[model samples]
Target: MSNPTELTHAPHRDDVGARMGMWLFLFTELLLFGGLFLVYAVYRHEYYSQFRVAALELNLSIGALNTVILLTSSLTVALSIGALQKGQKHLSVMLLLITDILALAFMVNKYFEWSTKIHHGIYPGSEHLLNLPDGQILFYGLYYIMTGLHALYIIIGLVFLTIVLGFVITGSVNKDSYVKLENAGLYWHLVDLIWIFLFPLFYLIQ
Candidate 1:
């Protein structure tokens, strides 16, 4: 029979394997977004003028504010990981909570931005949108599709961070076993990286 001591010991964790799996998952996400980028490039090329006009319709202030928010959140997440690595559990948890708040702020800003667009009749398939030229119509379609997907990613990342925060609180993730927090940090960075690409694509098309 296995020793009682062995039974009580924590199970061996494959940190390397876990990290590799996360990277692979991140690569697949990149592939998915890459395809959308290609489509955007193709359509934008054909409808450059319309794309610019459509881009102008987007709220620059909100886009810029969200950019700052996500960037700040990324910094906080990185700091949280560093804090955990250095055995500062309380600081790590605090920083992570700040990151989560920033994420929620980003979502709130997005809600207002989308609300403004919809209120202005710029959403997909609305009479005003449909009445626009084909390029403009296509522009709004892609806008909704890409930005909406990005928002979904933000929500997913929030859930991951929240769960990891719980782990940190319970001492499940500490200096000796912080791969979970590190992985969560990587995922949050990916979320920020995607927005870095998306901000320019949808907001700064001029």
Candidate 2:
């Protein structure tokens, strides 16, 4: 294996140092999420019928719409990176701005989705859900646990992206060094990936 110190000494051309560290971080993050997914799979199997029934309450169309929004945001982020590579500062910033807008839109959708469910007495351990079957309650319990954590990570990813955009706007970053953008994008893509799985698992009831 390569020496750890050797890795750090890589040339910093185009913010390569930052991106290298970010890629490594993303690998670890994926492993962590993998464990969570494993746990979810076990629980899902134990309560398959309940999960299926509970999933019907969620609007698949909304989940699908969010998926499209996240994918489009990812694409915009990609375009931003490409613009930076081409030394087109204005174009890169424009794309970043679009990303910010998309992030806000995503949060808006999430809020409405969650709130609508909450209002409909779909939340776990709520008085409103007092009449729900135990299995259905368990299904919603897992749903809240999984999706809540995912949402937290999405917020964190957005914060990181916003910080990177701030750097870009303040001239601390530029076309020659957009590794931070790439790093932030990695995190954003992870958020997107999680939601992709979440959509099918939580919204596609047989």
Q: What would the per-residue lDDT of candidate 2 be over residues 107-154, giving only the tens digit for each residue?
A: 888899999999987787789676877667776876788788887887
- Residue 183 of model 2: what lDDT? 88
TM-score of 2: 0.87
lDDT of 2 at 1: 57
Give the best candidate by TM-score. Answer: 1
Worst 10 residues of 1 by lDDT: 1-10
Q: Please give the lDDT score for candidate 2.
A: 0.82
lDDT for position 55 in model 1 = 90
lDDT per residue as tens, model 1, 4-111 = 435658786678899999999999999999999899999999999999988989888899999999999999999999998888889999999999999999999999
C-alpha TM-score for every candidate: 0.94, 0.87
Which ranges of candidate 1 are over 4 A from the true structure? 1-10
